[model samples]
Each structure stands twice: as structure tokens, then as C-alpha cells.
Target: MVLDAYASSNPDQVHEDVLQKSRDACYKARDAFYSCLEKESGKKPTEIASVGLLYPKECSLSRTEFVKSCRSSWGPETRGGILEKPYTFSSSSSKFVLLISDVSGGDLFMLEFMHMMTKLRPFVHSFLKEASKMFVLYIYTMGDRPYSRQMAKLLDPKGEYFGERIISRDDGTVRHQKSLDVVLGQEKAVLILDDTENAWPSHKDNLIVIERYHFFASSCKQFDHRFQSLSLLKSDESEPDGALATVLKVLKQTHSLFFEDGGEDLSGRDVRSLLKQVRKEILKGCKVVFSRVFPTKSQAEDHPLWRVAEGLGATCATEVDESVTHVVAVDVGTEKVRWAIREKKFVVHRGWIDAASYLWKKQPEENFGLEQLKKQGTDEKSDDVNI
Candidate 1:
């Protein structure tokens, strides 16, 4: 009764200095209360930043801890385990469920290992072995010739997939740019999987943008991405449904679609169109709106992010309405964000759009919540900053 009275009488409800919690307990409460706020905001983390909440002040500590922890509890493994079936294409903000509020300190290593493996995303041996069948594979990188050859040896030890097909920076025609001109394959039939889009400015139609695998502080700093490299983490993506596995499936489809006979010569068929058709399946029917993601003077349609979203087949509108399925924003304080929360619409950061575009599938919106993204999207004008 005294504690309750003190809590009620306290003028500053925003602070949790009155209570001290364990590492696990603090994070757990934070997750629970955020989970609660999400429920209050209509069961989606993207729904509201933190509207009027029923949570006590102590949970606020989790937000502070969150900056330090930052989704250790929200790994894809936590999202897996029968709660979600494979190929489940649901909204991450609202419908997603967590099996545990916070992983115990003892299991932190295992969770981190899983997340590390997922993010590390090494060149899959099986994927390469199989991929060699459908298409002629090559390793064209910005890395120096010696480093490129060494990495290629590590990837294709037998020299089966890319035997002498490797091209490095020294062999390129342009400076600080990657071009398909160095590649002998026909542009229409070739498909490129690269981490950086600017590396292939003229061949985006032929490019499949894969998420970068940052393993070093040097790479992170070079990219200006604030997140720690996966090299710092402990180990694994689930083998069955991880990025490599998913990409292989997509590759198979692309190959099938390209060779799909229509009693016409395959010479004129463009794999780029087929690749775009497959990529568009990710956010095909969704309508997205932007909130402070674009510069005030720039046309939203002209923004690279807008083009990426539209390329994924989502309709982008400046204003929100019933048809708006998502409002992509970096600022949680924006009016559009507020309207999205009240309307129970999915409110996510711009990374969600890019993630969908990169993975060629819809990423969990909860993972890219505005609050979650503010750390990365501090400079909203840096939309070109790949997550």
C-alpha cells in the first residue's frame, strides 16, 4: 500500500530510478511493457511509438536497456519454433508473436550465435553447387585481384562454378565502379547479386540486391551503419529457411521463368523483367506512405527509396487514408506517424521497405519500428544509407 501510494504520489512518472532490476529482469520487463504498449496501440509495435500507456515507470528502464540490448530478445529464431509456419507472410508489427519476453542470460550466447549466423550469411556451399547448374556464375568484386582470387578459392575450392571467370577491380574498365561490360554474358540473360547497388548503376535491372554481410568495424564505419558487425556476435540463420536457402529457391524460379518456352526464341527474353516480377511479389498489394523520409524540396517520387518501393510493386501515396497499409517514417514524432498509430496502420521505418526490396520478401515490420530505427536513421536525409 505504501509503495502504491508512493508511486501514485510521485510527480515524475517517467523515471524508473526508484527500482533497480537485474539484467534479465530489466530487459524482460521492458519487453513485456513494450509488448503491452504494442497491445494498447492495437497489437503492432509499428502502430504507436509510445502513446498513453498503462505501464508503470520501471519499464522505461527497458527503453534505456534496449539501446544497449537492442533486440537481443527479438531474433528470428525467437520468431520461429512453430509459432509461425514457414512461408508465413504476415505483418511483423501486429500479428507477430514472441515466445519469450527476454531470453535468460544463460541462453544469450546461443541466441547471439543464431543471430550471428543469420547475419554473417556466408557463401553457402550447397547453394553455389546447385546454382552452378542454372547459370554461369562469376565473382566480380571491388576487392583487389589477389583478395578476390583468394576468396573465390575459399568459395569454389574445386574451381567448378567460376573457373577463370573471376574479374577484379584491376580488370575493370572504370574507376570506383562495377560494370557488366567487363562480364562476357549477355546483359539481358545475366543476373547479378551484389550488396551495393551503386556498384552497378547501369545494370540495376539485372541486379538482385542482397543485404551486405558486415563482419568488421572497418566495413561498418565505411558504410556509416551504426550497428556492430556480425563478427562481434557469437554464431547461425536456420538452415532450412535462411537467406541462402531462400535465394536459391528464388534463383530456381528465375531460371525456370527465363527458360520457360513459349514457342519463341530464348535469345530475346530478358531475365531482368523476370527478376523484377519476382522481386515485386514481396510487397505486391501493399500501399506505402512516406513521413519525413524524403527531403522537403525533393519530390517523394524522385527519391531512391520511393523508386525502390514502387519497384517492389507497392503504391506510394503522400497522404494517408484507409488504403494506406504502411506509413514509412524515420521520425516517430511526425503527424503521419501519429495518424498511423491512431488508425491502427503499420508504421515502420524506411529500412522495412529496403529490407523487402533486398531480401525479395517482406521483412518483419516490428524489427524496423521507428523507435528501433531512430538509432540508424538519425539523419533522415540519409535514405541511401543501406541498413
Candidate 2:
């Protein structure tokens, strides 16, 4: 249904008719296989314990051949090969950074897999162009071999960025976890960018978590989320100052720090530690207090805002003191708000902390003050009453 809708909207971009026919053929083949299993097991289709147990050898072969033929007719196969060597760089350059990045939900989101309609995440091409100058870029994805290669082609059409360094699920371990063992060269020198942290549990020190990109309805559905997609909204993240742009700056800083000391030994240097230090400095030297932000009777220490403030290097206190630099409040009539006004401290809304967390930078207080929030609340309430 999603594909149909996308195809209708983008008639020239997708081969919806061909995909629909192919889907019908697959359905018919599946139904035939199920019927054969039902007959062999001497039971109804729903009563069969395992379809593989009753599947006949001849029927299995026939079904496999049919599917293979369908795939061949649908699209060309993706090419695969071993990467021989890294791309040539200037001889004067001092360092070569190793980067392993994911594809789906990281660089782009698949809207129609059959027709191959994808929405690229914001700043993807710009980020790649900037990072490629400092790093030997590689593509790592949990998707199948053909799909990964196809996406790599789309992302690097000129073949200048990721040259044959594409690793898919077929090349990874049987346990479905990515390991540095498969990656050649020094493990400590390599940095990984991926949206899903659990995919690389063993290499957390080398992994930098990225915000997941959801640009299609099916992509969000796969993760059990129902938010509006970028395609549906007809908007994308800010290209000039988006998450990818911010991450590129961090990557550049990490690369610079790795080669800063002019030392021969680069084994001890880790980008993860640098990333932590950069994050810790975002809200450093600031003391914060919250009012009417947590549920009544709930521990303030256990609240998410408290943990976020601490994580961003802010000191959280229940009571306002002389050192209080900011007061996070949702209500304008709170005592803390009045105290912050009297003390001339920054009195901001709950979104001030959230925006900093998402943008990885401190947002201006004037943009998220109590007056703006009150006006927003009034407008929403008026709309609700009218509805």
C-alpha cells in the first residue's frame, strides 16, 4: 500500500506496474509452495508445524529457480569484489583516518524497495565529501549484499568516495554483530558511524552513535514508530547546520587531535574519548534547577531532564542557590522563575535542554522562553477547543 501511494505520487520516478506484477508472481509462488507442503504433510495449511519439513525436494528447486528468474528479470545483480588498496592521496598529508559508516537509516531511507525509491538524509553528500578528504571511507550495513552495493553506488556514483570497501551482512559474523576482526588495519585508528549502537557492541569505543534518519513510512514502520516521514512532510533536516554537519566538524577535530602531537606512536589515541570530552564541554560550568518539570511525588534525581543536564556537564540542584545559572521551568508563575528573574539568571523552558541535546550545542534562551511557550500553549488550546 505504501509503495502504491508513493508510485502514484511519483509516477515517473518509480516502476510501480512492474513491481506490482512481480509481487503478484511471488505471492502465487508462495501459495503454490504452501499447498504442496499441505499435501505432503497430510494436513491443512494452518495445521502444518513447519513448512520446510514437508517441502518436497523437486518443489523447492522449482520455487528457487522461479524466484531467481523473477529477480533477474526485475533488476541487474550488484557487483562484488575485494578492495585492493586505499585511494591515492597527496604525499604531503600526514594522516589517514579510517571510517566505517552504515547505509540504511543513516545515509538514506528506502521508500519503495521494489522500485528502489529512496530519500537521502540531509547533508549526506556534503558530509561524505568533507570526510573523504581526511578518511578512507567504507560502507558497512546490516542489509543484504545486493542492496548494500546498490546503495553504495547511489551514494558514490563517481566511485571516488567508497571504492570497493563495502561490507554487508553476508561478510559479517553469524551472530549478526559487526567485529573489527573483519576490518583490516589498526583497530584503534578506525572510527565507526552508525545509527544503531547495538549492532557493534564489541566496538563501542570506536563507534559514534548518530541520530536515525526516518524518511519513509515503511522505514519508520520497521522500527515500530509512526511519526510522519520526511517524504510525507516534504522537508528534510537543515543541510548547513544539521546533525551530519555537526558530526563532520567533530570528525575533523578528532582527526586533527590524532595527528596533533607529531609523535610516531598513534596507537594510544582514541576518537571516542575526544568525543566525550567535546560533549562534556557543551554545558560546562553552569548550575541548573528545575521547577514543575517532573511529576508530583516522583524523585527529581530520577527524572530524564536531571540526567540530561548532568550528562551535558551542568550541576543539577533541587534548590536554587547563589551559584544557580539557569532555571528550567514550564510554568511562568513558579517561585524558581521569580527567583531567576531577581537573580538575573537564565530562565528557560524544558526544550532548551532538549534542543541542546539534539543539536549538540547550546540554543539561545530567548528562543525558548516562558512567554513563547505560553503563547504556543494558548494557540494549541484554542485550536483544540475549536476542533
Candidate 3:
């Protein structure tokens, strides 16, 4: 049997959907494995045991399509049960085992920290199939909460696999600490699985030492690096080194600069509030400027902050040539608007510029703050903008 680890994006913010997708992926993988086995053994899979997990709201597997699929695959299986509750299995019968987990945010971080072991599934399944005394556990981690009761409803009605539990935030350093301990102790061979980086370490003493296993922790890093690199377009001939181009260039180099998970995107609702604040500041005789990090050209064109500037009756310039280093040329009727990204810093030209045509009215000097004012404020309501 071939044991493997797979990772994919969570569907939107719905925790249930995320769990479902992960489980579906596992089944598909299992089916493929079975088909391969047929080619090798020249016989269909006689028996199988499986465990599936869900994250966030640990809803039990009800009599849903997901649970039904497991039942159909393994055949007239035993009825479902709850997490942390243990059940016994026949070690004499042939068995196949599957495990599922749902991970999010820092809870995921803890899992990644452990050097994960792979190939335990096939080994455990084969072992159970050969021995009459077999025990299989399906565990789920609900991120920071304990949703074991809900998850129990999602379990297989058949009693082929036993014991289900939810890993809570306070259970240990990791959300699913007890589950890890049980898997390590009960199963002679074990495989640690997850899609996120930084899975926390649980009871170090209880960890199972599987001599033969594979680790796959580079999953998240590869996706994250690719996301950061291709986020913007500086290759456009019409606006190379322009506002969008410069912003992209800077952001691509700064891997740590990420949109807060769930933070409003710079080009979305947050932009509106920021722009409104800018206008309010300008009206109070203060100069304000806006800048952004765009991972793509389309995003740059649709930036909300830019829209806010237009709504404020402020003249806006975009796709400026590389020779130009200013983002906006503004006028509060006192200090002209001048902003740009230069040498990886926000360069606001302090020189007076004609409000109507972005033409410099006077030379910029170091003491420009003496006559200019800067104000900072935040929106009371958060917007749906994310990086």
C-alpha cells in the first residue's frame, strides 16, 4: 500500500465546507489506491476501515452523503459513535483504516512543527487485516474548539473503526493533543497528517516512534512562496515602473508583508474608509496619501482606495512612468500633494505642486513638516478587504 499526504485550499470561510472537501479528497485517494491494488493483487479490496475528521465546528457525521460513502466502500459497517469514546474491532478480520483531520490558522501551525510521519495508513490497514485483534480510531481537530459531539454524527454507522474525539484548545499545546497520544500508543505504526504548517507538539512522551515513515511539511511553504511572487505585474510595457508596477515590485520582495488573515483587502471596503479619512484630513488642512500592494494588475485597477480618491473629487494619476516616483499629487490649498514609493520607502514629495495638473509649485525641503500637517485615524467598522 502507498501512503501519501495531500493539501488543498479551504473553500471560502465556511468551516463545514472545508472539512467536507478534505474528506472527499481522502476518499478519492483511497479509491485510486484500491484500483491500483486490483491491478497488483488481481482481486478487489475485501475489507476496509477508515476514519475522517472535520475542523472548526466539529459537527458529527450525520446520515449524510459523506458518511454514506464510507459505509458503501467498507460495506455493511457498524453504526457511528463519538470522539474519545473507544470501541473494539476483530484483529482476525481483514481491515482497512482511514483518518481525516481539519486544520486552521495557528492550530495548524502546531501540527507542522512535528516532523510528520507518512505511510502509517497502509501499514495499519494491512496489520489490522492480518490480525484478529484490530483497533482503528478516527480523530478530528476543531481548530480551537471542541466539537466532538457534532463530529460524532458524521462518523460511519458501521462499527469497523472505533473511538472518536475532538481536540480542544486547552487540551495541550496542540488542539488535538489527546488524539495524537492515542494514535501513537494504540497503533504500532502511525502517520501524522495535515495541510497547514506549525502543528503543535502534544505529550512528547506519548509520541509513537514509527521507524519507517515519510514526512511532508513543505506543502504550505510552496503555495505561500508562489502566492507572494506572482501577486503583481511589473512587466506591463504601457506602465512599467508605474504606480501598480512599483507597488508590485516592492511587495514581491517583501514576503512577510501579508494581508492579515481575513483582513480587508487594500482595494476593497477598507479603501473606502481610508479614502474618506483622507478627504476628511485634507479638509482639515492636512495632506494625506494612499498606497497599496497589488498581487495583480486587475486588483490594481479595481482598488477601492483609488475609487475613494475619485469620489472625493481629488484628481488621481495611475500607471505613471518609471521616471516618475510619486503616487499622488495633492493640494490642501497649503502644501501640494506629492507621494511616491522610492528605495523601498513611502516618499511623499513635500514640494508644493499644482493641485490641478501635478506640476511642482516649489522645491521640497527637509523641514517641509514645519508648514505641513499629518493626521492618522482608523475606521470604526472593519471592511472586507484582504491581501
Cα lDDT listed for each candidate: 0.60, 0.65, 0.31
Clashing pairs in 1: 113-235, 113-236, 117-235, 117-236, 118-236, 118-237
Candidate order by lDDT, highest to lowest? 2, 1, 3
Clashes of each: 6, 0, 54
Q: Give the C-alpha lDDT of model 3.
A: 0.31
The candidates, ranked best first by TM-score, are 1, 2, 3
Model 1, stretches more than 4 Å misplaced? 1-123, 236-238, 262-264, 374-387
Best by lDDT: 2
Winner by TM-score: 1
Pairs clashing in candidate 2?
Answer: none
Candidate 2 lDDT, 1-387, residue by residue in tens = 987677567675467666887999988987776565444333455553221111112233332244345334422211111223332222245445455566332233222233334545667788888888777778887877666676776677687888766767766754688766555434555678887778888887777666677766566788854456565666667888877887787778877776677665444566667666666677898899887777666788998779878877889998899999999887766788888999899988887887776567788989988888776562111111100
